[model samples]
Each structure stands twice: as structure tokens, then as C-alpha cells.
Target: MKAGLSLVACVLVAGGLGAAQDYSVVLPTVDVEGISEQDFTKGYVAPSNVEVNKNGLSIKETPQSIEAVDVQKNRNYGTNDLSSILEGNSGVDASYDTRGDGIKIRGFSVDGGDIYRDGVRDSGQIRRSTANIERVEILKGPASILYGRSQGGGVINLVSKKANFSPLYKLSARAGSWDRYGGMVDVNHVISDTFAVRLTGDYEQGKSWRDGVKYRNKMISPSFVVTNQDGTVSFEAQYTYDDAWRVPDRNPEKSVYDAMGISYNKGFAHNGDFVKDTLHFLRTELNAELVHDINLKWIAGYRKASQDFDNFFAGTYDVNTRMLTQNYAAQQTDNTTLSSTVLLNREFEGERVGHKVSFGYDYSIEKREPRLKYQRGFTASIDPFASSSSWNSARYDRVSTHNKHKAITHGVFIDDLITFDERYHLLIGGRYDWYEFKSTDINQNSRSYKDGAFSPRIGVLYDITPEHTLYASYSKSFAPYGGNGWVGVSTTTNDIQNLAKKQTNEQYEVGLKSEWANKRFMSTVAVYEIRHKNNRYNPDSNDPYLWAQRDEKSRGIELNLLGELAKGVYMRSSVGYMSAKTSGDEVYGYRNGLELENTTHWQGNVFLRYAYNDLWYLEGGVTAYSKRYHYVYNDAAKSAKGAHLPGFVRVDMSAGYKFSKHASMTLAVNNLFDKEYWRSSSRPGDRRSFMSTFVYEF
Candidate 1:
């Protein structure tokens, strides 16, 4: 990690010097007129163009619900992690769990394959860093037509900062409560008229308010691009190295603690509980204008990662005795993935109609190997309130199992947009995927399966007026018998039998997109329903190996508002109401009609920024969610009245001062009122904290 940091620093210094030497000779200025000033500086405003849809479509043109997060602007409020960024978005729920950041969109968990970088799948298991991320785009509802198999809820695409023909050099440093401090550097240099290079790096270390928790992260991304003077053809390459280490915190169940008359503030993690992850990523892309007004693009990416996980967690508690059962587990895993995409797009105009068409082919292969060790027994019981030292006495057995899993997927898709005059637009697309999964155990036993599915999408929009559009759409998605990436499919006979059934999802949606204040502000209101069939689940608690299939559904309404609300005031806000429940029969009849776990009925967020003057600004935001259940079967007898995680509201504020055009500073306070709440399974949200950041630009 140290060597990587030093290398990035050296490159930045050398590049900065070279840029300074050529700064005056090659730099040029041009006059501009009639451009809205808010378009350049409004942080809360949404971008007009989005890349998640493959086809070049403006946000207002897409029939489905979508949202984007401006990472640069969010930094003012100390929002750095992906989980925090999504938690404030509409119809999305995010939290930290034992396995790292866990996210759910519209009440469905986002599979590992659903997260993307520059429109390519990223299968790494580590918590992602935002140092090189410029913005995040989310497409809500089934996206299998373009992205292949995934959860029906949505997909998140992180757009990385790339080299451009713009000269820029920036340095930023931040510090906050909980011993948190970090520094970042972004440097972009135009080597010549046809080439440019960019480097971004950051190092962060912090101690958490939770016991026995500390974290450190190091990340560096360097990229370069080559293009013609006319920009008709271009090629780019980028590489990233990221290393992260942190103590894992597995807090005691809040409801269990209350029933046992114990405090839930403390975690069950021992001092030695820790997780370390390292990732290496490489990508290359090519784009060109073809004959007959067609465009061609090809992108390829590769990722390798290593993870070390060691933790001690609580299983159950005896209410009368105040005793807790502890278990020790450890594992090391390696993951690798290679993926590529080739796409062609063209548009033509006819006498009374216009058409735009896009087609693409995608291929990917992923592999994982994990070795496990664990110790679980009655002797591991301990006092609920015991100190961390008391839990250190537990021992882990030798390696129990070594397993390898691999998945290969191929997909072909095409989409077309038809326009009638200038008032009506229609979109139609379809995708066919072939997926294969294989698993092998140390005992020389292997199991494999193959599956295929076809997904279709259709939508139509009518121009209610020049500023408002009304639209409706339907889409479908599917997941193979075996899951993707590290969450490999089970090879057991019973499990395979239950999962063999085709697992599929279908969604219906309607929405209205409206532009206000001359396109300076925008709002979207959408209503959607998604039904999941043949959902796999564990049937018997005592027999963890047993599996079954069932059906589930989620219906919701969402509203998102972004951009300048007034003269000097900018606002971003969202509100969503969803009902996610099991719809079909289950092995345990009582489980039917139950609400999905880790989902809330109501969620909303509002953030506002007021530029009092050219030198000073004030910002504040509020995020709130209703009560959520940790388990699907949260009955009165199974869980105590106060066992569920209660709903809570949190407030955050920031103040910024611009000393000059070259430098600025921001002071932010998160969780302003010090609200204590549980965010996920046995995990508590951060307490009130303060952060200050300073930035310099050249």
C-alpha cells in the first residue's frame, strides 16, 4: 500500500511539472455567451445525459425512473461511501453488514453483478472507494435487457473520472471526529492537442465510535486517452489499485438485547476481528464513428481481488440467564473477473418518423476460491456484558473446506426508439442470455448447471407539453439456478432441486417527468409494481441445507426533485412508499404475507444549499425511514415488542467559505442531533460527528 501511494505521488508531481511547462504554450481561451450560470455550478442539479441506458438518451426521455448522485457536490456534507450515497436516494435502502456494504433497491437486494464501473460489471467484494468516481447513475426496475441477469429492482453504475483535454490540478484534505482524516489528489494534464493523462489518488484512515473498530483505505487510479483532433475516434486505458483494512463490527441484536435486559450499544467483535481486502482493476475502451452515420464502441475490463475475513459473532441469548452464545469464523478468498462489451448505434430520420437503434454483445467470466475454518459449540458461551478480552479465549478449528466456483455468461441484446412527429416516442428492446455455473469441493466432488432466459422491455411516452412527459413501461429480468459471483449456488441435491426452477421477475411502471424553471429544475413521479416468481429460500431453520421456492412482490410510488429551487437556493429531495411482501405459499404457512426483511414502508430525504454570498454558503439535509424488520417472520411471539429496529430521522448540516478562486473550506456536522439507530442486521448507524475539508485548485 505504501509503495502504491508513493508511486501515485511521484507520477502526479512529474505530470504537474510537465503540464506547467506547456501550460502557456498550448492553452487557449474562447468566448462563451447565453449559457446559464447555474448549469455550470449547481451541485444538486441533474445531468441531462446518462450512460446507463447504452443508447444516448436524456434523463427526461427514458420512460423508467432513474437518478444520479453528484459525488463532487456531495463531498461538502462529508458523504463519501456508496452506502451513504444510496441511502439518501429514493426507493433505495443501504447499510453495512458482516459481509460489507449491503444495498437494496425497491425492497430487493442488489446482486454483486448488478454494480458496475463505466457500464461494465464490477464483481469485487470489497467496499468501493469514491476517490476516482465522478458520479453514480442508477436505473430503477428490471434492466436485464441491457445489463443481462440481475435483481429486478435496479442497477448502479459508477462513472469514473477520465482524462479530458482540460488542464486541472486539485488538492484536498479532510478531518473529522472519530479520528478520521484523509487526503486526495486529482491532476489532469493535456499532453498535446490529441492526448491527455489524469491521475487520482486518496488515502484515508479512521477509528470508529464502535468498540474495536478501525479502518484504513488506499486507492490510486491513473488513466490516459488518445483521440484524433476531430474526436471521431478515441482510445483510453485505466488502472486502479485499492487496499482496505478494517475491524469488523457485528453488533448484538437490538431486539434480543432488549429482551435479555442488556445494552445493545456494544458490539460482539473481539479486538482481533478484522477484514482486509485488496483489488487490482484494469480497463480499456475504444470508440469510433463508422460509415453511414453509425457509431461503434468496445469496452473490456479485468478485476482481481483478495479478501481476509476473521470475526467473532453472537448467535443467541438466554433471556433469564443473560448468557450469549459466541461463534468464531475465518476465511480467505480470491476473486477474478473478465468482461467485455461491443455495441453499435445508429439514427436516421424519415419523412414523418425518426428511428434510433442500438445493439450489443456482452461476455463475462468470474471465478472464486474460498477456504473456511470455524468453531461453534456450547463452551463458547459468555456473559452478555463481558469485556472484549473475555471473547478472545475462543478458538477456531483447522480449515474445514476448500471450494471453487465459476460462472460464465453470454448475452445479445438490441433496442430501438421510434419517434412519431415530435410528440410520441416508443422504445422496444430484448435480450437473450446463456449462463453456466460450476462448483468443485476439496473432496473431488463437482456439480454444474446451465440455464438460459430471454428478457423483453417496452415503453411509450407522450409529450403532454413541451416541459412535461407522461410515460409507461414494462420489463422483465431473470436469475439463473445458481447466483453470480461470490454468492455461489448451492450444490446440494435439495438446494439444487429447489433452485432449478426458473427464477424470474416482471415489472410494470408509469411515470411523469417534468422540467421546471426553464429546465433549471426537474421532478419525476413514478409508480411501479414488481413480481418475483420461484424465489429460493431456506425452508427449515433446523435443517439449514433444506431449500424451497416461493413468490414475492413489491409495489411502490416514488417522487424525486432536484435542481435550483429558487434564486440562490438549490435542493435535492426524494420520497418513496413501498409494500414488499411474500405473495405465495411457503413451507411455513405463517411466513406468507410477511414483509420482506431489511425493508421500510416509508423513506424520504431532503437536502438544501443556500449560497448567501459569493464567499459563504450554508447547507443542510434530513433523512428518515420508517421501522423495518430484520427477519421476514417477525411475529409477536417470535420477537419481543421492542425487538424491531425503530425508525429514526437524522439531520446533517454544512457551512462553506471560499477564500478565493483557488481555495475553499467546508465544515460539516453529520447526525446533528446525535440520533442512535440500528441500520442493518446487528449493525448500528454512526453517531454525531464533525468534519472539515480544505481544497485548493490550480
Candidate 2:
């Protein structure tokens, strides 16, 4: 695990080795002029067209380190939601969990890979919120050979928002600073030339900079499409619903020297200010595609996702008695997910040796249930309306377990892309998966486990001209573990039967992709090495725990830049050098173990944009973090190393105007100067926030 590779060859020789600049600095100049007279030219489209080319479902073609977040660049940089539009790029990072929207790519988290939409499978597996996105694709490394069981860190595809034949309409609204608010409406209708209809809706509310945080959310998505006439056959249906509410743990723990609060403890300020929970989710998707131009093709899909969660917080905190509390804890949850997919696309040698073949099948099912409650003599000084059912109910804790988890997966895949005379090319793929798990508790007693796996991938492309391309690839992956949620509770600690082994990964890559001068801009450079095996740490089995097996390794180097470095200035940047270890672990028993926590060595992002004539636009950006270590102890007073968490820089600015072409307005400033950070290892990251937005178009 230590492929910092001389720190990525010292940041590409300080951004000067193998030179890759098309332009950087020297900006200003508006006017798109028919957007450069488009005739198909904009970052690799055609992964089945629908504006394709975002990296064409990546996996190889320069094999790893892919990033994309361009849906009109997330609306000219207002970049609302989805964690600041995926903030920095490269290997990505955007922390804040414990129910505050999570994202941690590369260093794992975000439920370890494979979250898709548009390529199916996007139930968001719990703790959710993504407002029916329309862009965001990241495939860094070890993609379980393209979505099988996941987690060698790499994969995130949320591209939903389609249905635009022509006629369109849009409406947007946002207001910020604490009492936040939101609005959105996007509709596209072309009920003719083959039919189409797309609708999107959104709503939001806020108040959580710190004191008794608050939140509210709503989302609705609708879609239907029908097209057939030379363009293959297409039929689609979609429905999404989301509702959210929060106010848990209600941060508010100021106590550095204490005097600033003369009133002593303000610890449990929730009761009247915040302390709530609610969540609901529903989804349905159905798709079908049959393209018959004789090149052979077929695709099918179906999905159903459901979720419900209700929780009540505040368990106990007195700090100094500046408050009163009793009756703590509550939870109720239910989840369901089902998925299916089938695909086939073919063309085998004939037409000057440009062979292509693809076949795929997938299935997923999940179910979960959780219910826990304990409340006794609740009393935060009663008064302001009591009666949480007069409190008192606490007993269930013989481990108070409840389980209902079921998972099944079946997969078959084959891919081959060969083009020998076009300038040497070859792509290969293989997949086979059969996994199953079933459990039923709460006395209903039942258990089951099954497994089968295989995955492989390979790629090579060298066109070197006609627009540069040099690539390399190798991939393999398999990760399965009853499907998440394993924090041991029965069967003598760290249970789940030895963590159900089935985790393996391998990835090696090299890259270069280019477009010079005429293509308007594009660049990429990648290097990667990834490894993981066994990785099932189970012990503490019902207490004194004692079960172990582990493995890990992650390596990196990536740099990416995107288009239009001229003409009203447009830019995007990425810099990354990652390190993750634990290769061959055995801690306490002496083995490979060291590294993991905050996971970073270097991370970066830079964005610059400007516009003046469509009535003005402006943008600025910078993001950085470096410094790792937060846990893994060998007794430094109970084990702690490199307790460093200081290395952060943020700057953001925004401006927008266009009071005509159908109205517009925008204003933003985030952390502009009020820098204060702590992306949640327990909350604190919201210093300078401000936003204003409005728009309408037809």
C-alpha cells in the first residue's frame, strides 16, 4: 500500500512533466457563437447516445480515474446540493455523515461504489438525498469490474433527468443563510415526433449552521418516453418520491474555556428548538430498449425501491445542568429494494475489423427492518406540553435485535471491443456472479448464505492522433457481504459469520486522452494501483470479541482538466495523490495495520469561470485538504497517531445575471473568508454561507 509513487512523481514534476496544458490563465471574452457550431464534439459522447460520452460508462478506455459533473456544469456553478456538486473532482471527497448527507469516494464510504441512475441501480441504499440529479459520474478505480458486488472504491453514476425532445421550461429558486429555502421545476414536453415527457420537482428548508440544526426536503421526479423510428426502440417510465426531516443530535456543544456561556450548559437545547426525524422514499423505474439496425441489440430493466424511517433523538447530555432531559432514543425503519437488468449489444468483425460485443444481466433485492425504543420517566422539566405517552418503557435489550435482510444477485457479462485497423484497440470483459443471503429474526428464525463470483476486464487504445489517445487497463473485483449493515450484535460478537468473506480486488492503470486546439479542449492523466482481499474484520463476538482477517491497499495519481479555456473562460481542475493502507492486517497480534482515518495525503480542486455578455456570470473556486489519521491505537493513551486534522483552504464566489432570455439571477458566497471547518467527525462545517437564486425560462 504506499504507491504515493514519489508523491505522484512530485505532482507531475510540479505540473511540468509530460506537459499537458492547453491553456490556463489569460481569461475573459464572451460569445459562444452557436456553441462552436456543434456537429458532435464535446467530451466523448455516444455510449448509446443520449448525449453519451461522459466517459462512456468508463471502466477502461484509459482504464481508471474518470470524473464528470457537467450538466451545464451544474447550472453555471451555483452548484447547489449533491454536496456542492461533487465539490472538488479527482478522487473526490465530501464528508459529513451521521445523517448529514454523505460522500467519500475513493477512501470508501458512499456505500462503497456502484450507485447508478441511467445505468440503473440507484436506490441510494439508506441515509439518502440526491434530488433526482442529472449529472455526476465518478469511476476512480476497481469498479467491481463494472458493478457486481462493490467496494474497491470507485463508481458513482447519478445521471437522471432526461426527456427533452425540444420544447422545454425551467424554473428555479433558492434563498439561503440559515432559514434556507428551495424550489425547482423542470419540464420538457414533446408529445409528438415519438413522444416524450419529463418533469422534475424539488423543495427544501433549512436552519442548521449549528444551534439545534434543522432540515426539511422534498423531491418528485416523473418521466415517460417513447421513441422508435430508426433510432431503435425506447420506452421508459420513472417515478421517484422523497421526503425528509431532521434535527438529530442537534449540535451545540460550545465549551472551549466555558465563560462565553456564563449560563453554563446549553447541551440539550433541542426539545423546543430541534429534535426530530422523519424519512420516506419511494421509487419505481421500468425501461426497455430494442435497437434493430441489425447490429444486434437489446436492453431491459425494472426497479422498485422503498424506504421509511422515523427516529426521535436526545439520549442524555447534562454538561452542567443548563438543561433537563429524560426519555431518550427512538427508531423505526423499513426498507425494500428490488432490481433487474438485461442487456445485449453486438457487432462482431466484418466491416473492416471493428468488432464489438456486450451481454449483461443483473438482479438485486434487499429488505431491512429496525425498531428500537427505550424511554423511561422522561423529563426535560416537562411543562411545555408533556405526554410522550407518559414515558416509561424500557426492557427490550437482550440485544434487542430485529433482522430481515435478504439479498440475491445473479450476473452474466461479456464485452469485447476490437478495432485493429483504426489505430490498434482492444477491450475485454467478463463477469459471473451468484450471491444470496437471507435472514429473519425477531424470533421468526431463519438464515441463509450463498456465493459465487468472477470478474475481469482489460483495455488498450492507442490512436495517438486524430485527437490523441493512449491507454492501458486491467481490472478484477468481487465484494459481497450480506449487503451492508454489519456491526455485530449476536452470535458472540462481530458475528455475521466471520463477516462472510468475498472481497477481492485488483486494478492497475495508466492513461492519457486528448483533444487539441480544434476540439476546444480536454485532457486527462491517470495512474492507479488498488488492492483489497479477505477484509472481514470480525471479533468482539458477543463481547470480548476475537475474529480477524483484513487486507487493503489503495494508490493514486490523477489530474484532469476540461474544455473551453477561452471565450468567456470556462475551466475545471483536479489534483489528487491518495494513500490508503492496512495491507495485510493483524494489529494487536502484530501484522499489517496502520493507515485509515480522514484518509488523505493530498486532495485538490480548482475552478474558474467567467462570462459577460449573456448578461454577466462569474465564478471562482479552490478546495484542499491534507493531513490524515484519526484512529488506530497502540496505546498513546489508548492508541492514537497522527491526530492531525489541520489542512484546509476554501474560497468560493459566484455571480449570475441574465434578466432576459427568460429571466435569471444568482449570488453566492461560501466560506469566501469565514473559513472554519470540520466536515463532521461529529459536526461543524458551515461558516460563511449565503445564496440567492431565481430563474425562469421557456
Candidate 3:
């Protein structure tokens, strides 16, 4: 915060000339301190304005719902990961075990493929870090037309930090409960008027409260930018290496769990088992304004990743003999991808109206080996009360997978923003996609699968007032038989034989939005219905095969309030009530609705931060959920009807003080009550913990 102000002060003192002549800048500086917090978002006040133009309109002018949180606000609250950043924004529920995306938005789960970084797909089994993130932008509704192959549930984009003209450096360290310790470094430098570079790195190691569960992460990202009078070009390369001993949580039979009368904190993982993940990412981008009110933007990227997982857990147990049946599985994957996107935007006058139109094309190719090497996993003979020495051994080989897959995708789309009478805005877009999936084995046997579809989106916005807007939209999405990623299918024909064709998704949404307090506060109410296909586990069938529900649907109402509440107080809060159900031969749960398992019926969070003068600040928040169903063998068995995982409320708080212009310290407590609860029927929540951080800037 001080570094930014110092730059502004220098610009004002020098009368807009702060650097060399060739790379000099100009600005009319008057009152940097007098600037209203509502005009921009930093700290707590959410920004009503956004820079990304995928919607082709200003935030308030766009028909879709969007929300963003800057880096400073995330730092002040001690958020360390993507899921942590989404906790209280717009009724989103997020959780991460330092692995995949545990985020749920509007009754839909966001997997690795559903998440994006800087308008590109960054999904995989790798963990996402906030160390190099500038802010998180969430665009709600179906994004298949803008981004390739997505669910009707929206997208989460992590914007990375970039090089700037100003030079700055920051260093920070943290220590916390469960033997957690880590540090981070951020540095930016300008080489010349037209060239700049930035570097960010972080390292962390922690031991969990649960026995034999530990993890480590090391990440580094370097970015460069070239400044041009008409436009700019930027490049970034990031790498992350992570390893952990994780225990995949599985809820025990309700009656069996009750009979043991033991805590759920204990895990079934052995100390020798481990999971390792590595990722390398590279991107180059250009933004240039063309002649005659036209603009062109291009981006090219490459990503390579590998994951090795060894899982072992107790599937069934015999209490009489204390025999634990250890189920084990091993998975290895290596993936490489190359992608590019080109966009052209133009503005012109129509006969009776004005128009802003966008045309873009996206292309990508992916090669993946879901099974890199076949590993022999064994079932171990063990007892809960016995020593670890009794466990069996697991072995792995280096041979490549028999069936490695390759995928190619092509999509082209055009969108237009038409304004009539300068009050009503209409947005219409459509896209066409061609996808091909091929598989090859060591024996030279090969097969290919191809699919194609069209997606469309239409929305209209009316400016009821200058600060208030009403909008409604309809959108459609398409997901190929096995999804977009190459890892989903193999040469084995029967793997996806049941799904001979693609699946479709659709959504309808209506929303109202208003802002006040110099654009410092914004409130929205949205009602939406989402329909899609689902694959669920059903034990009722004689063979116990996975059940398919072709017409699964989710309907919900969401309300959110963000921005400043008073002079020095700010809050971000949201709550929602949703019902997600399946219409099929299999009907389970209460009211014959058989709501989707683990779907959050009601969930919300409230985050507040208050500043006391220039040196002291405090932050706190609460997250809660309503009851949700756990897995049951018989849904219509008549006797087992209202079974659900208990709901919980968790609290988090933090306090920080700026000792000087260049230094600060903060202390935080998470899971304040040490609550006993489960999320998505996965596992018990983390226990209460404390952490303190010290930071220095130069």
C-alpha cells in the first residue's frame, strides 16, 4: 500500500515526469490521499468497475453478474489460496486440501477444467497459488461461448501480477500451529522506458494435526512486459513443485461409525504413501489498437504437468477380528498442452444505433497419459490399534501407459453489444466448436472420436437508473462425451460406451443490481435455473453400476451485498437457497426429490474488515451451511429418509498493525471454535489454529 502511494507522490512532485524521457509518463496529480475509496477497489471496498472486456461492456452495463477482489484485500485477510479467496464472495463455497478445486458455485462444483487463469484454461491436478495472483474475477452464468467447453456454472479467473514502471520489493514470513512455516518474495524492476520485469516466489511446509499427514510447496513465476505507445506485450513463465501424504476421506457407514464411538480425525493413509505434482506454464500476449476504431489481442500459451498418486484406505472392516481391508490404487499422469486465442474488437455506428462487436477464435491441442506406468498395489493386513510395521508394500514401474490420448479443439465466436437510444443494451453471441479425441496403445492399435456442437447466449440490460440496472439472460453449454480433457477417455472402447454422444447444459437467469456511496457499495439479487446431465453411484441395481440421470436440474436464489458500510468499514457477504435434484428412475431422499448428494441447500458467509486510522486494521468472517445428504445404499428404503451430514459454522479473525511505512505484522486465528463438521461428506474440518506474519517492503 505504501509503495503505491510513494509512486503517486513522486509523480505529483515531479509534475508527471517521474522517469527517463524515453519512458516518461504524464498525469495531473492533485490529491492522491483525497481519492475516494469507492472509485476503485483495494482493501475492502469492492470495485464496481472491471478492466477485462469479455462481456463487451462496463461492469454495470453488462448483463451478467461479476465480482472481483484485489490483492491487497486478500493479503490483509491472510488468504493464501484460490479457495480461501472465494469463501465469502457472492455465496460461493470453497475448500482446498492443497490439491484440486474444492469450490462450489451456484450449486455446481468447479473442477480443474472449469477454472481459468487470465482468460485461459489453467486446469489440471496441480494446486493453484495466490503468490503471483493480482486479483480473482468470477463471471457468473454459462461461459462456454467465451471459454471453450464449460458447465453452465460460470468460471474463476486468477489474474497474475505483472511488471510495472515503478520498482518495488516485498518480503514476508509466517509461522503457525501444526508446525507450519513459510515465506514469500515479490520484486519488480524496470529495465528501460519500454521494458520491465517482475518475479515472485514462495515456499511453504506444514504438518497436519492428523497423524502422518504433511505437505510442501515451492513455486516461482517470472514475468516481463514491453510498453508501446499504441499497446503493450507481456510474457510470463511459472513453475510449481508440490508433494504430500494425503488421505482421501471416505465417510464410514453411519451405523458402523456410531458403533465404534471414535473420532473421525484419524485417517487411513500410511506414512510411506505419497502424492507428487509438478507443473510448468508459459504465456505470451499482445494487445494493440488497430486503425479505424478497431483493436486486436492475441495470446499463446503452453503447459506441461505430471502427477503421481498412491492411495490406500480402509474400505470395509470386521470389528470382531479387527481386520481392516485396505483398498489401494495408484494413478500416474503426464500432460502437455499448447493453446492460442485471437480476438478482434471494433466499434461503429449503425443506421439507428451504435455497436461494439467482438470476434474471436480459440485453438488448442493436448496430449495426456492418464496411466504413465502400471503399478502393483497390494491390500495390507493391519489393525487400527497395531503398529505401522505390519503394513504391506506397494510397487510402481516406469513403463508408459498402454493407451495415451491426444485431444484437439477449435472454436470460433462472435459477440455484439447493440445499444438503442443509449439506454437499452442487447448482447448476443454464438460459437461453433470442433473437437477430436484420439487414443494409441503400445501395440499400435488406435482409435479416434470426434464431436461438434453450437452454443449461444443472449441477454438484455435496461438502465432503470444511472446506478441501477435490470437484466435477464439465457445461455447454453456443451460437454463432449468424456469431457474436454484427454485424460477422460482411453483406447478401451467400453470405458465410455454408455455415453455415445455429447451432453448439453442450459441456464436461465434474471437479476437486479444497484450501487451507492460513490460506487463503493453494490447489491444484487439473482434467480436462476440450471439443467444438465449427471453420473452418480447407485448401489440399488443388482450389479451396482453407476446410474445416469439425463435431466438433472438445479434452481436457486442468490443475494449478495458488497463494499463499504461506513467511513472505515467494509464488508463482503452473500447467501443462497438452492435445490438440486434429479428426475429419473432412481428417486431418493426426502419429498421424493432426492436432492443431489453433497449439494449445498443453503450456504453463506460474511466477511468484514475495519480500519482504525492508518496503522491498525482488523478482519473477521463467518461461514455456515445447511444440512446436506450423505451417501446411502438405499434411498427409497422407507426407513432411511432424512439422513444428512451435520452442518457447521466456522469463524476466522485477524489483526494487523503497520509499524512503519515499510513494515507490518499480523496475527490470525482460523476455525475459531474448533468445530466438528464435514464438507461434502468428505472429512472432518481442520481444527483451530493460529498464525502470525511479519512483512517488510522496500
On lDDT, the candidate that comes out on top is 1
TM-score of each: 0.90, 0.31, 0.86
Task: List where candidate 1 sits over 4 angstroms from the true fold.
Answer: 1-42, 259-265, 319-322, 375-379, 482-487, 495-497, 539-544, 632-642
Q: What are the lDDT scores of the predictions, listed in order?
A: 0.77, 0.56, 0.65
The pairs that clash in candidate 3 are: 588-594
Any runs in candidate 3 off by more than 4 Å, and if so which? 1-43, 48-56, 70-81, 88-99, 230-259, 349-352, 372-378, 387-402, 441-445, 482-487, 493-498, 533-549, 585-592, 634-643
Q: Best to worst by TM-score, what's the order?
A: 1, 3, 2
Give the total clashing residue pairs for model 3: 1
Q: Which segments of model 2 are wrong by more than 4 Å? A: 1-65, 68-137, 140-147, 150-210, 214-371, 374-401, 404-422, 438-440, 449-513, 517-570, 573-606, 609-651, 654-687, 690-698
Question: What digit string (tens of lDDT, one per residue) describes model 1 on residues 441-531?
Answer: 7686788878899999999999999999999999999877633224356765655666676668899999999999998899999999999
Candidate 3, after superposition: displacement of residue 508 in Å?
0.4
User: What TM-score does model 1 achieve against the real structure?
Assistant: 0.90
Model 2: per-residue lDDT, tens digit, 224-338?
6654442233445666676666555333222221322422112233343332323332333222222221121122334443333333333334456434343433445455555
Q: What TM-score does candidate 3 reach?
A: 0.86
